[model samples]
Target chain A: MSRVPLTRKGFDAMRVSVIHTADDIVREHIVNKSVVMFDILRASSTISTALANGCQEVIPVVEVDEALAIASRLPEDTCILGGERSAVKLPGFHLGNSPLEYTPEVVAHKTVILTTTNGTKAIRRAAGEDGVVLIGSLLNYSAVAHKLFAAEQDILLACAGTRGKFSLEDTFAAGLVVAELVQLWYSRHNAAPEESCSPQADPVPIYAEEVPVLPENGLLLEDAAVAALRLAEAYRHKPLRALYDALHGQKLAQMGLSIDLNFCAQLNLYDVVPVYREGKITCL
Target chain B: MSRVPLTRKGFDAMRVSVIHTADDIVREHIVNKSVVMFDILRASSTISTALANGCQEVIPVVEVDEALAIASRLPEDTCILGGERSAVKLPGFHLGNSPLEYTPEVVAHKTVILTTTNGTKAIRRAAGEDGVVLIGSLLNYSAVAHKLFAAEQDILLACAGTRGKFSLEDTFAAGLVVAELVQLWYSRHNAAPEESCSPQADPVPIYAEEVPVLPENGLLLEDAAVAALRLAEAYRHKPLRALYDALHGQKLAQMGLSIDLNFCAQLNLYDVVPVYREGKITCL
Candidate 1:
């Protein structure tokens, strides 16, 4: 199959959809688009932070036994086992699913074998697809959006909901990313004429194909995408309050993991974009 | 199993969770709560309006053949077959899944055998649960919330998403319902002081057991619930824009069913609360 690069002319054809849970993902939706997976309460945030802190790579497995089985085969000193079940550290693992735990000293230059209740399952579901799969969260919101805008592919924001149910934090994080992409697309379209093309100066078809294909009226926004952007804007003022009051976050806090809430709430704390391909997540 | 009437004392235990898709519902979540199903784009809205318009009852079947089988057994003059597939009316059916077609003259004193792509399946999923099942939408938002508040039971907003993926309009409608419930709960708590027991009034513990048992901070808002409320508020001002721009709504409009859009976009158009019990939906 031949691939056609998405030019500015295809901007109108560009679309954004949200898969609110792993169970809702359809193979057709991920076939030829860039998929952004968000498990904002911890997993995506942790992986992005680990990559930013110089972790070599993070392997996400769905089960504890699978994580342990893979960890045993790797060099003992090079790989550290990590993950959580029911908001606590799994027995005999080096670390739990906490963003703060994936610090520079602990994960620097090490391969982290990680798994969690929901995030790892969503990652595995998106693996082996024909397109790129990237992990995102509040921690790397802008960086992920920047990458998606540059790629110019139709975007699918896949939220790893809590236990196959719709989760607030993940969906909010997805909305934040969509809002950023919309803003970037609009700014570029507005600046296109001032940069190189003027109606009076340009007689040739210079950058004609580069012009956007938005409708004569304006950009077309999907209702779901618009709702998501509105949701992000509604809760934009208090990032920490939004997380702290989320169902999953409150559950984590009740389990004595309030520190994780503080860490996940930090917006754009990491400059890294974690790209998941071929069963592993690495910094892009 | 014995049932406990949800009193003011049980308010803290009266949790509200949003199941963003039919697939996300677990048997446990519906075991002892009032489940309000929202498929705001069409089905629930249609059914609610039908009941409000004096339709005798609505029988929701998962398959068209089943609908046909049931219609064959009933009086042809009294029962009307209605449904849709892929947003179009099924061939040979008496009516498609459009609210406007269910006007008083056509459907009054008649039983409508109805099925749709997503809404009926969700109704079936919650059919045998031990708790109450009610149909809700923007058309009957206040009525549904009023019933739930009076029941004082735990609430679950079940969104019949588009083919199991989260649908924005449904979630937004769910959020609207949640926001109303929260406001009602708070207002009742504040008004308790002036109702029965006062600072120096008689204290015979008349409403002592009825006092709410909220945590030290008062009401505990789940993150998913809060997100839904915010989403509803975000699109509250532009209800028609919210409906017309929704992904499902756009698809319907593209199919030349813009009439459905205009009908479903009417907020609180009907005062009826459609109750689904024993495999049928009827006005409460």
Candidate 2:
């Protein structure tokens, strides 16, 4: 193929790209980037709840057999096999991927052997200690944003989309995370000094375009991230509406799981960021 | 992967998805779908300009050598070898992808054998007689959207991004097309009957979520398409700013091609839609 290389690689700004699904991720794009993976509907919400509720650790495996094998190695009483295949609790599993199911009494002091169709596989595939993998969802987006801001590396929001297609809820959650990061970045680095901001600095600009410019060392949101931020802005007044906008949410609502939707849509309810490093997810 | 299928497949409505870059397109998603391939930086814009300015026919080839070979077969005086590699005019080629250069005086009534880094290849690769492929850009998006609405098939906006990564201009143009299609849909299909519009129809709803539901037989913008639409909405007041916001546009500006940028960003200056079918691009 006769083509030029993407020139953005030489750019020095802190960049963010929202990979719509795990299937769409390019390894090179995320190889050295800090990742915040979102499976907003359930898996991520479940992980956050388990961690906040005192679970010792969450082992996100890619396959059910792997989870079962890992559980088999641990003492039966010390491990809880918890996950869903096609949104149903697998045979002999204690939980069905609902955040409510990971209550303190049920998950406390136990190791969660988890696998889901999308989220767990994404977690297993994208995990690398060098990338600072963090599990994100509405329940922990602000905490995730704080980590992303402090890390100051190229960022990727890997959305564990439903069944290898773009999932609205995951993208919406990603947009929320991006919005928070932008807010945090601006708060940490205030506008130019009043003297430099004076109109006399430059009577003329390069282009008379109204688009916001990324200041030096400021974050550069890619096109996908910018789109996601717009989405987040549109749903700022009612974040839960975003969850309900997805067909996955409608399916869950039809299956009498609106309770879980309500539970997962609460932003920053738990001040926890689950860091996935060296194969285990524990609170940051 | 243990997963349920994406439930939206069985949906009874018009659906749209925006594939961010040529490399990201899934063949299955576009198998029987009508596609508007956009390389908004230049290729599509150039094609629109050529067709609008009275070119006989435009044949898109994937390689410069293929173009040269094809031009060799045609009478030299009748065929115009046109295209660019890395935004530079190829050796012996007549054009370097700037819309302004394809004046009627130069290309009128001549066959254009064109190849470019992104858009032309996407056109050659995605063209099928049955899918109703069309070359689209900011230049002809409305006309393309008109064809899309009239065709009544699943729609795709395939962005021929800068290299293998997403291009901001292409996605923004896609968002504009989506907005147009939406406006046309709403204009053609007015609200439900006045009787059905009454408040007493149902005092309760399925979920208390504030989402604009897709009316029967209406368009279902997928998550990516939805994001694109949001982007279009963000720049609705200052459409041209979207072009300058892209790194590609900045590169072009640095190379003194802002004339092409301004030419491409005008929403619908050319009242032409170039249909790519049977390996040739001609007016619809």
Error of 1 at B272 (Å): 1.1
Instruction: List model 2 lDDT by residue over B1-284, tens digit each.
Output: 11111122443567787887787666676775777899988999999999999999999898888998999999988988888877888988888788888999989999998898888878865553344478888877888888777777778888888777777788888888888878777677764423211111121133354333344676777767766776777666555667765767766765766677777878888889998877789998
Candidate 1 wrong stretches, greater than 4 Å: A1-12, A23-26, A61-81, A90-95, A129-132, A191-224, B1-12, B23-26, B62-81, B89-95, B129-132, B191-223
Candidate 1 reaches a DockQ of 0.18
TM-score (C-alpha, index-matched) for candidate 1: 0.80
**Which RMSD values do the candidates have, in order?**
9.2, 6.9
Off by over 4 Å in 2: A1-12, A128-132, A192-215, B1-12, B128-131, B192-215
The number of clashing residue pairs in each candidate reads 2, 0
TM-score of every candidate relative to the true structure: 0.80, 0.86
